[model samples]
Target: MPEIKKYLSIVALGENRDKLARDLVGAIARRGCEVNECRITPLGDHFSAAMLLAGNWSAMGKMESALPGLAEHLGLAIQFQHARPAEPQTDFRPYAAEVVAPQQPRLLGELLDFFTEQETNVVEVSSQAYDSGLTGAAMCTLHMALQVPVNHHPQTLRDAFMDVCDDLHADGLLDPIKT
Candidate 1:
C-alpha cells in the first residue's frame, strides 16, 4: 500500500530580514518536509509568509516539534495547522478580476461583498495602495483569482461587474484566466 501523505499549513510573521526565507525553507528541508506552495512578501517593515508543506507522518511530526524553537530563534511569530489539498472543482471556471480606483474606506470590503453575493470563490487576492503620479490622488489596485460558477453567464457577469465599478467610480475588468 502507498503511504499517505500529510500536510501542514503555516503562517509566519517577523521583521524583514534577508535570510528569513532561506532559514525557514532550510528548516523545513532539514525536517524532511517539502514545500508544496508558499507566498512570502515584505509588508511595510514586516515580513509575512504562508506555506503549505507535505511529508509523511513521521516527517510531519518532526516539523511540528521543531517549528517552535526555530520560530523563537528567528524572532518570528508562527502558526500552523494540519491541512488537506484543495479538491478540483469541475463546476467552476477560473477567472481573473482587476480593479483600480481612488483609494477610499471600505473599497476592498465592498468588492469582496460583491464576490460573496455572486457566489464566486476567491482563490487568491493581492492589493496595493499608492498615489497617482499624474493626479497626486491616492489610488488602489486590486487583483483576484476567482473560481466562478459555470451556471452564471459570462457576459452577464461582466456587465454586472462593470455596473458595480461605475457605482464605485472605479475601472475594472473580469476575464477568464489563460493557462
Candidate 2:
C-alpha cells in the first residue's frame, strides 16, 4: 500500500469553543479516523479550527461526507481534503503521539508551535477526542529523500511533544496526569 495522507480543516465559530472542538473531534474519531494536526484560533466573535486528517482512501472518503454535517451542527464552515501527490516511495519512520489538553483552544496553538520548532514537517496529521478533555494523535513521519540535515528519530518528535506539553502546562492548559 502506498503512503496516502489527507487533511481536514474546519472553521468553527460559537460560544463554546472547547465543546465544539471536542465534539468535532469525537465525530471524526467515531468514524474510525484520526486527526493529525489540530489547530484552533480565536477570530473575534468566533473561533476558527483547522484539523489535518490522515487516513487511507476509505477512511478519508468517509470523513469527507460526515464532516460537513458536523460543522453545521457547530455552526461553522468545514473544509477537508486528502493530501495530494500521494505518499512517497519510501517508508517513513512514523511515531504515533498522544496528547491531552484541558485548556482546549490553546492546545491547537501549542501543537502547531511545537512542530515548527522541532524542524519536523507534519507529514500526516489527524485527531480525535476522548471525554471532556481533547485527545489528539499525530503521526510524525519524515521524508527521507529530503536534503534536510536533521535525521529522523523518535527523540525529535518526543522533544517537540514535550515542549508543547511544558508550554501548555505552564499556561494551565494541561493538568497533572491522574495516576
Q: Which segments of model 1 are wrong by more than 4 Å?
A: none
Per-model root-mean-square deviation over C-alphas: 0.9, 11.8
**Model 1 Cα lDDT, one tens digit per residue, 8-84:** 99999999988889999999999999999999998889999999999999999999999899999988999999999
TM-score of each: 0.97, 0.42
What lDDT does model 2 reach? 0.55
Error of 1 at 95 (Å): 0.5
Q: Single out the weakest 10-residue window by summed lDDT for candidate 2.
A: 140-149
Which one is best on lDDT? 1
Tell me the spans in candidate 2 whose CA falls farther than 4 Å from its real position: 1-18, 84-179
In model 1, the Cα lDDT at residue 125 comes to: 93
Candidate 1, run of 10 with poorest lDDT? 104-113
Candidate 1 Cα RMSD (Å): 0.9
Query: How many backbone clashes does every candidate have?
Result: 0, 6
